[model samples]
Target: MPPIPIDNEGDPRLAAYTSIREKDLTSGHGARFIIEGKVTLETAVRRGRFALESIFIADSRIEPLAELLARVPADVPVYTAPQSVMDKVTGFPMHRGVLACGLKGEIPDPAAFLESGVSAASTLLLLSDLSNHDNIGACFRNAAAFGASAVLMDAQCCDPLYRKAIRVSSGSTLWLPYAQGGTGLDMVNAAKAAGYEVWAMTPRTDAASLTSLPVPARLAILLGAEGPGLPDEVIAACRAVRIPMSEGFDSVNVATAGAITLSHVFTAAV
Candidate 1:
């Protein structure tokens, strides 16, 4: 389909793209979420997870993205506007000049997804109360890199579908299968019941060193927010493991820790 011209930012068809920053800060993108950047957009299209509501791109990007835009279903409208209009519509400077609105489907039940969505020799990443989009995205990227089966997050965790999170993950969030909601303990219990050994990552000196423990065939690495870390009760519910550091240092960034632990599991499982 040919690109449709969007001469004005206030056009009703551009409603989803308008005031993006304000909307993201308040009610979020609602039933649909925004996808930004060429790479992330490409990943979203290739994954075919979310339904494409529409795509909005700067007129300058049409030729460059011609091949990619062609792959989009004809039913999905592609809107092209000048850089200034795009910036006004999105409430930000149009840098990458590519954006898409992806419609979310019904969220999967966390327990059922854990029990049946994954099978033998699977590794899952469990996140609790992680607020930073960058950290969440990095963890997803690491999980995908190490071939983890899926990611599960508690109610307190930030949305992995957040635009920044998706961008930071280099679009890993677009492809990764994840379920959100439920408590940390709820996740741990479900994983345990599903035959996964839940390992809570912590900084406690007394916790078993990660290097000292053998990686399990079916493992779930549980992590928490940066400063407060995992709740005491949540940690107590699982086998606690700590990554070794120098004499004084006891911890690393949550995402770094995730990469380290996931690499161990991936290497051992393979």
Candidate 2:
């Protein structure tokens, strides 16, 4: 399809691309989310899990991104605008020159997603009150790398579809299946009911080390926010396991912790 030339910043056709940074915060629950940068946009186009509602690119990107543009559905609008217009529309530099609007389907219930015939050796990750977008994105990237079946997060977790998160995940956010909603305990119970042995990652001295714990036939690892870690009640409900650290160091970034734990679980399972 020939790209539509967007001359006017206020054109209604470009509404989805306007104030993108702000919209990334308020939008996405009702099926729409923004995709930024060439890598994530390419991932979105290749995955086909989310419908491409429209695409807006800086005129400078048209030639370089021609291959990716060709993969987009013919019916989806592809608009090209000057760098100035693109920056004005999105309220940013638009340096990457690629942006897209995507429509995602409803998130499935945690129980249904867990019980949906997941393999016995599968590993799942549960996040609670994880409000940092970068950590969410990095965790998703780790999940993709380790072959985690799905990532489930409580309502307090930030949206993984947020533009920065998507970009940081290198578009793995689009490839991985995720469910958001419900409390930490609710996630633990659901996983237990679905035949998963839940392991809570904590830094407590008494907890078993990740290397020492036995990998279960089916496992779900629960990771919490940075400082507080998992709620005491939530930790008590599952087996508490820790990654052994040097005596002076008690913690790592949640994303790094998740990656280390996921690698351990995946390698053990294999």
Candidate 3:
């Protein structure tokens, strides 16, 4: 079949490509969606999704994406364009000639998602006021790497579906469980309800160091945002704990701290 050459930027078919960030947050009826650049698109398709809608490519750069393009369904439209038009359509530079849109049906409910759905819910990740998209994305990627069950955020935090977050995550946000409501206080309450000891990672002297927290049958670790750490109230909510970082350094990036904390916390608790 001949490729569909969408030459004009204003073509109705190019609508979704125009404002990528907005398009991403639209929760369509069918499935939870994700947008993938050419390289990441390959990984997403291999991992499996509910549906693969279409693959957009630049005519000039088609060779690199050709093999992957061939794998897309015959009826799914694969639209191509010159490099300049492709960039204009996508609202970003360096698209490398492709973007793939996919839908997945498996989304975890906010309250129960962290249950781990395996042998005891051992690992968890908490976010307090982590506003940076890049940082949150890194946090999700790190959470997944550490075998964490979910990434919990306060209601005021950034949207995980925000375009920059998705791009930075390499679409890994779709692979993990997450939610935001109330504050770190809410997460502290939920963790307790779920039968886990809640440990707030802060620098206060009264807190138990990570070394001493009990090896509960289950555990939840609360990590805060960049500068402010967790609110005093939220920290108060946790059983009270710290990571014992070396003196002099202020504090680590929230995601980095979480990665480190999770590694140790899970080892002790589960």
Candidate 4:
């Protein structure tokens, strides 16, 4: 099966990639979202192993894409054109010659999510008000690397399936299970109801230190985005917890903090 080759900017096959030009990532006729650039492309394909629909490149990079060219399915479309056209359509000079789109999806319910983990698994990153795709994606990558069983984002958070998040996660977003539409409050209740101890990551004076908390058999670490921090009600909903930090700096980036917390939890208990 030879690859589907498309060269024209106006080609209908390029529809998904095209609307990105108009900044319409999607309007709901069902199109795979795209992540553009080399790092993201490599991550999306190899690490996340996302269900990629196709790859697009410019005429100038037939040789550059060689490493992945052979691996791409023969039936997947690969589009190329003069640098001028790709640049005009994409709104910038191309760097990767590799733009790929992937399917949108949701993971199963959290109970099923918990059941999928190894019996000895230890930690989960529970995200509440994470709105930035960059932060959410990085959190997933951090969770994956630090041995968190899974990453969970509240419905108020951005879709982990969004292109920016998928790329920021270095495709770890795809590798991890994600759910949508549930809120921070719902996550806390669910965590408690499921028998997993919930630790709301907050900097309040009385919060227990991450390393000092009685490590539980199953744990969910709740995180809020920076600036606003956790809502008072959300923080009050769980046993409060905080990461140890240097003097005068009582905080870490939510993603970095998640990594640190997960590292501690993973080694301490199931």
Instruction: List per-prediction Cα lDDT, in the order shown.
Output: 0.87, 0.87, 0.69, 0.72
Instruction: Give the alpha carbon lDDT tens digit for every residue of 1-270 in model 2.
Output: 889998899999988788877755334455688898898988989984787889999999999999889888999989999999999998879889899988876776577677775434378989999999899999999999998978989888988888888988989988788887788899899989988899999999999999988888789999999998999999999999999999899899999999999999888767
TM-score of each: 0.95, 0.95, 0.81, 0.85
Our model 1 lands, by Cα RMSD against the true structure, at 1.8
Tens digit per residue, CA lDDT, model 4, 206-250: 898887877887888889989888898988888899887777888
lDDT of 1 by residue, 1-270 (tens): 799998988899999888887776213344788898999999988785778899999999999998998899999999999999999999989798999998876656468777675535478999999999999999999999999878999878888878899999989888788887788889899889888899999999889999899887788999999999999999999999999889989889999999999998888877
Clash pairs of candidate 2? none
- Pairs of colliding residues, candidate 1: none
RMSD of each: 1.8, 1.6, 3.5, 3.0
Of models 3 and 4, which has the larger TM-score? 4
After superposing candidate 3, which stretches have Cα over 4 Å from the reference?
A: 1-3, 21-36, 48-52, 70-76, 102-109, 112-120, 266-270
Question: What's the CA error at residue 220 for candidate 1, in Å?
Answer: 0.3
What ranges in model 2 sit over 4 Å off? Answer: 25-29, 116-121
Whole-model alpha-carbon lDDT for candidate 4: 0.72
